[model samples]
Target: MKVRTDAKRDEILEIARGVFLELGYERASMAEISTRVGGSKATLYGYFPSKDALFLAIVNRLAEQYVLPATERLEQSLDEDPRVALQRFGEQFLTFISDAEAVAAYRVVVSEAAHSDIGESFYESGPKRTVESVARYLEGAMDRKHLRRADPAIAAQHLLALLAHGEPWHQYFLRKAPSPTRAQIKRIVERALDVFLNGYKS
Candidate 1:
């Protein structure tokens, strides 16, 4: 039996990410992933019990590397002005999700959601946690009177939606348009913040 190690787990994840991107979730097979990783299917099962579990792990790993840090930093910015704090968070959020790898993962999740629970699993593992984190920050802002009283959870959803709307990123996600420039990201974030603050500012 192959002894499981973090290195092996990471190798599996990295290889599986490529397979999923290349073939999408439905078409990508555990056998293909095992073959790519140079391991038996039993060895792959030892690391990840199922394909859904493996996919969620990849998504969670990406979230931990990027999204979680940005949300955690939101706490550090609590003393700053609401606009400043939100602008920083929005820009970081947009930049990460607009990344090619991240977009590819989203595409996989969306495509597979109708047929399986992978979409719900992905949301529960990554997006739901992000929404909850942002909601906590917004709750604090409301208490500090920087923002008007409202449902922080709903506000967080609205802010995320606004940030995601219209952009080279949105265009890219829909039609394989070119990757967004930094200037385009900054402009998009600024516009999102403008609309968010106008509605929520105290």
Candidate 2:
């Protein structure tokens, strides 16, 4: 039996990501990925049980790479002004989701959601975890009297919603607009923080 190494697993993930992006979730098959990886279907299956599982793994990886760092910064900056901390996190969060890979994965998940549980799985693996992390930070802020007392989870959702509002990424997701520039993201985050702090400041 061959030893499963992290390098090999990463290679498989990279290849699978490309396949999914090029062919989409419904059209991309394990067989095709296996062929592309220069490996047998059994070997590929050993790493990822199904297409849904593979796709979820990709989402999880992306979240770890992008979302986790932003949330970590939010946690670390707890001593800073709420507006400053949130502005930094909001900018990073918007930038990550607006990425081409993230946008493509979102398209796949939305398209496959009605047909299977991939959407739920994707949410569980990625968005849900990020939300929980943000909620924890918000809860800490509330405890410190930096923000008003409220349901942290709901507050986190509201803050994130505000951050995403009217961004070009929403239209880009629908192929109607281009990816937002850094200037646009900075403007959006500042506006969002202004409104959020106005409502929630303690």
Candidate 3:
């Protein structure tokens, strides 16, 4: 058994991310990733076990780096207006998911979902985790009477659905629309929050 370090693991993840972006999920292979990492296939497998595992790790890293902190910021607003915290989260979520590269990655995941488990891996690592984080915040809001008591999971899904709507989201997924401007994103989020809070407020 070869010893592994955080440095080597990070190196593998960076290289794998590049390969996945360039060749996409279906075409990006572990052997190719190993070559780019300047390591033997055995070593790369020792670190990640399989291509799916490597891909999931990359997804997890990206989600944690870009998405988790935004949702976390909501916790600090417990004493403030719930609308403020929800708006911040909605904006951040929309912006992150609408990035060009992020859209491309999602397309790749969706394209390969029927043939591979990458879709499940992606949902578990990224979207599911994010929803759970949001649900926790919503649960807290309900407990404090900042929002009405209800099923936090269902409420979380409804809030995300509202934020994820609009022509920008649909067209971007089709690879035909540009990223939403900051002002556009703010408007969308504000409107979504308005609808959500109105329906959920005690």
Worst 10 residues of 2 by lDDT: 163-172
Please write out the lDDT profile of model 2 over residues 137-199, one tens digit for every residue.
999999999999999999888888887655564576877466789998899898888888888
Task: Report the number of backbone clashes for model 1.
Answer: 0
State which candidate has the highest TM-score: 2
Q: Of models 1 and 3, which has the larger TM-score?
A: 1
Give the Å shift of residue 80 in candidate 1. Answer: 0.9
lDDT per residue as tens, model 3, 37-116: 99899999898888878877887787787898887887667877888788888888899888887887788788879988
How many angstroms is residue 86 displaced in model 3 relative to the true structure, after the best TM-score fit? Answer: 1.0
lDDT of 2 at 40: 98
C-alpha local distance difference test of each model = 0.88, 0.88, 0.85
**For every candidate, C-alpha RMSD to the true structure in Å:** 1.6, 1.3, 1.7
Count steric clashes of candidate 3: 0
Clashing pairs in 3: none
Candidate structures ordered by lDDT, highest first = 1, 2, 3
lDDT of 1 by residue, 1-202 (tens): 5578999999999999999888987889999999999989999999999998999899889989999999999966777898888888888888888888888888878888998899889988888999999999999989989999999999999999898864554596877865677888888988888888999989
Query: Ten-residue segment with the worst summed lDDT in candidate 1?
Result: 165-174
Off by over 4 Å in 3: none
